[model samples]
Target: MKNINSKKLLPINMNSIIEGHMVIIKPISKKEINKTYLSWLNDSQINKYLEVRHNKQTINGIFDYVNSHRSRENSEVFAIFTKKGIHIGNIGVIYDKDNKYVEYGIMIGNKKAQMLGLGGEATILMFEFLFKNKGFRKIFNGVISKNESSWKLFESIGSTREGILRGQCICSSKKPCDVYLYGILRKEWLNSRKKYLNILKNIKIKNG
Candidate 1:
């Protein structure tokens, strides 16, 4: 089997914030890792499709996890904040330098913030930043098969359903769940930027 070296020694330089009309993503800080953040990981419903749900989470564990990524060069974690400056969730990326690609994961920790399309806005912002600013060739995302909304959101951003990793995740259901791999090339996203921007504009206007 060919080894996939996902980590790189180069820093992501996540100092600048990526902003959308509805949300802004900035590097996560130690101050943000509080009890509420801890609860997001431990909540069964919140983490139903997340691997972190497999283990019980504590404040210390959450801190350690956040710190580990903070100190890593290839990994970046960002706190998702609304235009009102409320921190609602977190998104992260790990650079697969060898493959010239990036893998991302996201979670909307605040229940009140869920279903408002904030996650979608954050995702578009992330894609634009990584593709236009970072010079990455591609971006990848994976979703549990049962998470229809998540996968559909990714598709709306022009990511293709690349493949399925059979029984890759043991979900909260205690049953093995297939993982849906979604990927988008930088050029493809760039080409569709106008269409997506229009959609985003409509969403903003509608929401406001």
Candidate 2:
């Protein structure tokens, strides 16, 4: 994997508490992707809700996608690991120049890590980095309506429902699905720090 310039890597406020847990968000590394990671891509349970097709993710394909995105301007992808060094998932933010908006996405591939608020913690950290360090004005995300867990995760972190895109996404099932758009502004995020901090606190307690 390509190395991210520490200078260019935005710094987030490590002190923000989410669910009473102190989660750390850091840059991804090649070590995070191994044979086990490839197996994750092949896992039907994990790929069911993702946009990418599992059959398309060859070893080279994974490396190329990660390296290319890492080198892109206004885009960042971080491997979500706990301070204890457990790999939970990955999260990314993409800034659209044409719309002047940033969009974010994440996945918790580890079944053991699901529903534990780790995704929310990682997202909060990334959102702070985008708004404070990158000077992004707004951030948005689209979650399939069927993915209630993901929708709840976004809302728990202060994003508001923007609108619904009917028949917007076609999953591997080949059926059209409604995509729910959610977004948060810099001002809205600033106001949500307290709630996020509380969530972080809880996460720390649970992890401990």
Candidate 3:
């Protein structure tokens, strides 16, 4: 990566939001709910590591969940879609208003769309939104220790591993796994965004 140039850095007040090559992050709405995205909760493979997917899910139940989340003032939930408008996943930040921080999460629900760097792009866009638009200074996230790939993803985006909760989550094989906590400060993001944006700029969008 080259040194970030003042000209190449992203503008803080850009009007268009959620633009990306492999994916687009659109605010979650009742109108966007569908069988594909809804099925993710019921899919054992897709929801293996997610705490919210532990119970059985129905269309009505999922609908209620979305409605309840939308009612919140501090949540910024969004549906992750492919450039061609195919729904693949969701991502968002849960704000801790009193503490002046946020906890973030993301999921790429479609198995067919996994491993294509779509989730990574959606995450970067969401982080940029939090830091630039929403005025959030501290952002935090966690990944199951068993899920090495996810931890790597966060590290690649410049998050620092702060702590670990051992044996907190029971895994698919019935073994307890740790959850690795990571965080990003505003100063770190200011530096990281430049390198990340450069990478995004160089990435070739296949029919995006």
lDDT of each: 0.79, 0.69, 0.73
In Å, residue 168's CA in model 3 sits off its true spot by 0.6
TM-score each candidate.
0.86, 0.79, 0.83
Superior candidate under TM-score, 1 versus 3 = 1
Each prediction's RMSD over C-alphas, in Å, is 6.2, 5.8, 10.1
lDDT of 1 by residue, 1-208 (tens): 1222222222334676766678878877766777888888899999998878889987677655655565555567889988898889998888776888988899999999999999988888788778887788999989999999999999987999999999998888789999999999999999867767754453321110
Worst 10 residues of 1 by lDDT: 1-10
Residues 1-208 of candidate 2 have per-residue lDDT tens digits of 3463432333221222222253555555667667666677778788777766536566665665565565656665667776677777877666677877887888888788888777776777677667766678999999999899899878877889999999987866789889999999999988886776655344431111
lDDT against true structure, model 2: 0.69
Best by lDDT: 1
Q: Rank the candidates by TM-score, best first.
A: 1, 3, 2
By lDDT, rank the candidates, best first. 1, 3, 2
**Candidate achieving the largest TM-score:** 1
lDDT of 3 at 55: 83
